[model samples]
Target: MFVLTMYVMLLTLDDYKPTYQDRLATPGMMIRPKGNALEISYNSEDTESWDLYVQALDNFLAPYNESQQIMNNKDCTPNTYFIQEDAGEIRNNPKRSCQFNRTVLGNCSGINDRYYGYPDGQPCVLIKLNRVIGMLPGKDDQSPYVTCGAKVNYSQPLVAVKFLNVTYNADINVECKINSLAIANPTSDRDKFAGRVSFKLRINKN
Candidate 1:
């Protein structure tokens, strides 16, 4: 009876399918540099301070290069769904995903500007969304976009704070919100960072 029961239970299980799925509707966001705290502090003129950030961005973008996508992934129709059917197994695992080249970032591609605008005081921060299984995001054909706003604006006049006598130093609190028709931005305290991320940026001249 034990041997017969074991054989019957094995037939019901699948190798590729998971028993449970993530119930969360919104995915977490991540940023580059990966500091211990939610702060990005670096000197504008100091190359050593920001070199690690540049290297981290370069390494993360290696797999998204045009050459890499051409060799590994297939080119699918733009602004359309890519439905791939699982064919019979072969010697090599062929391409099943659509091509996503780093060139899509244009100036932020890090091709022409290898430093990623770090030396020029305009630092580039890369944001990534966590992957979810069997998740079809966005309502229409339009893609998702990220929008960021700053708590303090230097362009506008401020009566509370003055920088007339201060040296070259800037500290700004910024928040980035990810917008999508399918994704939900909860207002509750527990789910405050559901589809958004906040970080402090500090740049010093010394």
Candidate 2:
């Protein structure tokens, strides 16, 4: 049985100190990690509605409910998102709010910048797909049979790129689906095998 799991964690370039770029460390400025750590698990019998990434989103930002729910949570998406929904909110709240006058979220001027851990609102993230313990779906037939990145856009963020394709994908938005990916159910949503690939997201400052 081949199972795929993904890590969803938050880190600053100075704190996490990953072996690669810090892109995979955070999904977006709005989304936070559960206990500052999270992951997505899947196999073949999952459903599209049962999105793995969405589930992770809930877990990651579970502690910061007040603002996370209001500004970033899908449930609160229906209503208007105020830059000051929780202006005075601190510690487990949206770190970015013009009303709050907080630089904890970094520099809003960098918003949309191709850098992670930046206060820029561009929502850049880093991903480190660890080596799968077992054989991947479509892997080489040699000793080092490993896995690679897969197609999980059905639940991935709005714009995922600089890795395989260019930074283009209108679908990624504030819907909270920006950081999640659809479950990999066999046949129906059988995207990529999470077991084989381990890569860091590429950030192009251009």
Candidate 3:
């Protein structure tokens, strides 16, 4: 069985108090540049790690945008915001984390989660952010700190996953593993099973 793990770092920024012309400079950019951007990095050892990470990130961010809308009490519907995913693999186990850094336009807060699939067609894993590792920023902090983790029986294979946002950046690294049970009896006519996949996600401000 193949074991996959991933790490991601995210950057959070707030206080986009830019002037009208400054905002006009980039009319359509989703994240306005107003405050310092938080920098987050994720690391993983398994191949296909980045794919899972991106999937979770997409899932997490979609709701985050909505939460922001509710907080602002604006007439806007919570919609998916576009993001760029740039990731790479590290041969050395010591350097197996994905890095996310950006300057956000407004005040936002949230947490991130990691998800992945297991061998033997088991359910997907859902890693929730624990208080120790998944704490968000308080109402009066510089920026919120995101947390991440996994749940064993809450993962599934990537057949046709739906993401709320359009991915502007993405990177994938994958490694395949043979199913020992399937290999043991070639003539058994059992379906071949894929290895496993893992992911990371960040929460949006509330």
Q: Candidate 2 residues 1-206, lDDT tens each?
A: 12322222233222312335432221222222111223212221234322443344334324334554356443322123423333363433433422221112222112223132221213322222332222132323221121224222111111122123323222221212222222132211132222221222222331
Task: Order the candidate numbers by lDDT, best to worst.
Answer: 1, 2, 3
What tens digits encode model 1's per-residue C-alpha lDDT throughout 1-206? 99999999888775655556768777666666555477877787898987887888788889989999998888988767776556666323342678877766545568877886667766666666666656566567656666664221111001011112222477777676666777665222586567667777777886
The list of candidate 1 runs beyond 4 A from truth reads 1-17, 86-95, 150-168, 185-188
| TM-score against truth, every candidate | 0.75, 0.18, 0.18
What overall lDDT goes with each candidate model? 0.63, 0.26, 0.24
In the order shown, the candidates' Cα RMSDs to the true structure are 8.1, 20.4, 23.7
Lowest-scoring 10 consecutive residues by lDDT in candidate 3?
A: 25-34
Cand. 2 TM to true fold: 0.18
* TM value for model 3: 0.18
User: Which portions of model 2 miss their true places by more than 4 Å?
Assistant: 1-114, 137-206
Q: Which stretches of candidate 3 lie over 4 Å from their true place?
A: 1-16, 19-48, 55-65, 77-206
Instruction: Supply the global lDDT for candidate 1.
Output: 0.63
- lDDT (Cα, tens digit) per residue for candidate 3, span 10-46: 1222123212222111111111111122211223333
For model 1 the TM-score comes to 0.75
